[model samples]
Target: MKSKSNKSICKICGSDFARSGMTRHIKSCLGKHFKAKTKGKAKRLYYLHIYAFYNPDYFLHILISENARLEDLDNFLRDIWVECCGHMSSFMRPGQHQEIGMKNKINEIFEPGLTFSYMYDFGDTTELSIKNIEIFNGAIKSKKKIQLISRNSPPLVACDECNKNMAEIICAQCQWDGTGWLCKKCAKNHECGDEMFLPVVNSPRTGVCGYTGD
Candidate 1:
C-alpha cells in the first residue's frame, strides 16, 4: 500500500495517524492493547521521537529503555535507518563533549524536554534530530532494549521526470542538482545512466553514499 506522507503507523493498533496526533493516539492504543505491565525490574521507558533534521518527512517514534546504552540506540538506528557502510555514529547535545555522550547510558543524558542530534556516516552524513518525548515510570513487556512504537510509513515520492509514477530509483549525482527521481519506466532514459542510480528506499539516506536500504 502507498504510505501516508505526513502520517505514521501505530504498531499497537495498525492504524495511521497524522504526525500531530500520533503521540496521543499511540498512548491510547497502547493502553487498550497492552494491559500487561512489566513483571521483573522497576524499569523506566523513555519515549523518543527521531526525525530527519532538514526534511521531517521521515520519522520514528520509539520507546527505549533507560538502562540501554547510547550505543544501543545508535545500533538500532543503524539497523533500521542509516547503516550502509558501517561508518561511525554518535549522539550529541550542543556544547557537550562528544565522548561524554558516546560513553553514557541513554538515561544519563536524557531529561524532560531534552533534545539532541545524531550523526551517522561522517563522510556523507545523515543527520537526525532526536527529542525525548516523555518518560514512563513502568516498562512495556519487551526483551528488546529499543521498541519501535510507531514509524512514518514511507513517504510517497513520484517520479520527477514524469510526475506520474512512483519513483523507483534516485540518481546520486543528479539528486544534488534536484532532478533525479525516476520510475522504472523513466529510469530507462535517465541521463546520468544506471551506474549512478540508487534504489529509492524508505530512508533519509536515500541517494546518499552507498545506502540502498537498511
Candidate 2:
C-alpha cells in the first residue's frame, strides 16, 4: 500500500523535519539544552535500529547506555509508539521460547548484528524486530535511558477512493482489504461511518485498538 509523508514534528522544538535529517537535527538542536545530562564518567553505548516486522520501512534508530535494561527500552517503545492501556510486554530471541526480562542489561545479551523480537499486548499484539546495528563509547546527553537518533519517514498513502488527495483516515473494518484509506471528505460519507475510522498516524501500531501515537 502507498504510505504518507515521511516528515515528523520535533516535540521539543516544534520544528518540521524529514525522517532522514531528524537524527542530525536532534543532536545539536536547542531543545537538548533543557534536558538533564549524565554527570559522571562517559560509558559505552549501543545504537539500535528497530523496525516493524511486517512494515520494515516504519522504523526508529536509538541509543542506549550499555547498562540500560531491557525494561528501559520497553518503556521507551511504549511512550513513543504503542502504549495505550497498561499492557504486558516481552523480548526474546527469534524462534526461542525463552523470554528476556526487563531487568537484563542490554550489553549482557545484545551485540552488533544480533536480532531480537519484542511483543506488546498479548492480544492484538504489536511485534517489533530489533537489531543491534552499532556499538560505541560515547557521552550520553540526557538522564533518560533511551535517546532518539532518527526514524523512517511516514509512508505517503493516497486516498483509496479519491486516489488523489492524501489519506487522513483509515476504516477499521476495511483495513485488511487494503481499501480503507480515505481523505477527510471521503471519510465523512464512508459506509463504515465516522466511528470506524481512525486517524492516519506515523506508526505500525496505527489502527490497533486505542493507539493514537505520542
Candidate 3:
C-alpha cells in the first residue's frame, strides 16, 4: 500500500513543490499558454501608491506603478485634495528619451522620478486603469510621507531643550538645546542609557517632561 506521507510530483512538470513559489516558477515556461488562456479573463484589481507635492497651487506625483492607470491615480489624489489640477507624464530610463509632447504607447513603461502632471477637475470621483508595472522609491522610506513639506512650512515640533523647531524626530536623550541637537553619536549615547535620559523636569516652560500637576 502507498503511504499517505508520500510526496507527489506535478503532472504538468515532473518536479516536486511543497507550495508557494511553484506556480510562479511554472509561469515563465508556460507564460505564452497562460497569457493566451487568460486573454478574455476578467480584469484583475490593482492599487496605485502615489506621492504628490503641492506648491503655488500646482500638483505633481511620482507615478509608482502601472497596475492602475494614470487616470486612476489622479482620481485618488483629487479625493485627497479637491482644489488642485492634475497632469500625467511618463519617464524613461537614464539613457532613454521621449517625444517632446505626445501620448505614450500602450506598452510604454514608467520609471522612478518620471513626472506626471494633472489638473484637478474639481470632481468628486477620479479613476483610471493601466497594465501591471513596478516603481522603485529609492532607499529612503522615512521621508516618503513628507511629500508636502516645504521650506516655508511651519516647524512640526519645537524641541524644548534646544529651543529649535524640528520637523522630524527628536533624540529622546538630549535636552532641547542648540547643542542638545546632539549629533547622531550623542543620540546613540542616550539610547545607551545616558544620564540626560533620566526622568527630570528640564523644560518647565515647554512642559516636555514633568510630574502630574507641578
Candidate 4:
C-alpha cells in the first residue's frame, strides 16, 4: 500500500510536493509547460467524482477527455480498483436497465447534474455511483485518457479481536455475523481459520471472491 502522506513526486520535474499543491505547481513547471505549448491542442475535459455505491467513503475524483470513450473510463476503474478474474462489467443510466457500451462518447452521455452507475463482476458485483461534477476546456499534461485528480486514502479497519493492530484480513463468511476484521496474528487464530480470510486491500471489491486488488 502507498503511504498516506499528502506528498507526491512530480513526474515532470522529479520534484516532491504536497498532493494539493502539485496541480498548481505542474501548470508552471518548465517541462510540462513546454510540452503543452508543443502539443498546441487543448481538449474539452470532464471532472467526475465517483464513489462505491454501498461504501460511499471510498471515492475518487478524475478527469477524462470529453472525446474519450466510455470504455476508457471503464478500463481506468478496473485498473485502479476492481479488476479481478476478468469478470464482466457494464454501465447503466439511472433508473434504466439498459447497459451503456464502450463506444459511447463521454460528452454525449454525461453532463453536470447527471449520475451514472457502473457494475463490475456480474455475480459478486462491485457497484460505483458516478457524478459529473464539472466540465473544463483546457490543456492536459498527460496523454492518458483518464487522469486521477484525487482519491480517498485507504481506510483503516481495526482488528475485531484485539481491537488494536490494523486489520490485514477479512473473513467473508464471518462478515455477515459482524466479526470479520482481523490483524495478521489474530487471523491465524481466527475461529473460522485462515482459509476463510481474504487479504484486506484498498478497494471496494476487497474480500469479494478471489479479489485481492491491484
Candidate 4 lDDT tens digits, 1-214: 2123334454445676654565456445533443456445767778777889997657776778899999999889998999989999999998887899889999999988788999999899999999886676665566788777566566777787788888889998887676887789988888887678788887889889888785
Cα lDDT tens digits, model 3, 54-157, are 22212121222224444444344434433222333332233434322233321243432343333332232222112222332222113232121111112123
- Native-structure RMSD, model 2: 4.7
Model 4's alpha-carbon lDDT is: 0.77
Q: Which portions of model 2 miss their true places by more than 4 Å?
A: 4-40
Candidate numbers, best lDDT first, in rank order: 1, 2, 4, 3
lDDT of 3 at 191: 53
lDDT of 2 by residue, 1-214 (tens): 4764557665446676875666556555523542345335767778777889888768887878899999889989998878978789899986785899789999997988889999989998999999886675566665876777666667888998889888888898887898898988888888988788788887888888777775
Each model's C-alpha lDDT? Answer: 0.80, 0.78, 0.29, 0.77
TM-scores, each model vs. reference: 0.89, 0.82, 0.23, 0.81
Please tell me which predicted candidate would have the highest lDDT against the true structure: 1
The 10-residue segment of model 3 with minimum total lDDT is 146-155
> Which of the two candidates, 1 or 3, achieves a greater lDDT against the reference?
1
What is the lDDT, from 0 to 100, of the residue 190 in candidate 3? 45
TM-score top scorer: 1
lDDT of 1 by residue, 159-196 (tens): 88888898888888887766788889988987779899
Q: Candidates 1 and 3: which is better by TM-score?
A: 1
lDDT of 3 at 22: 36
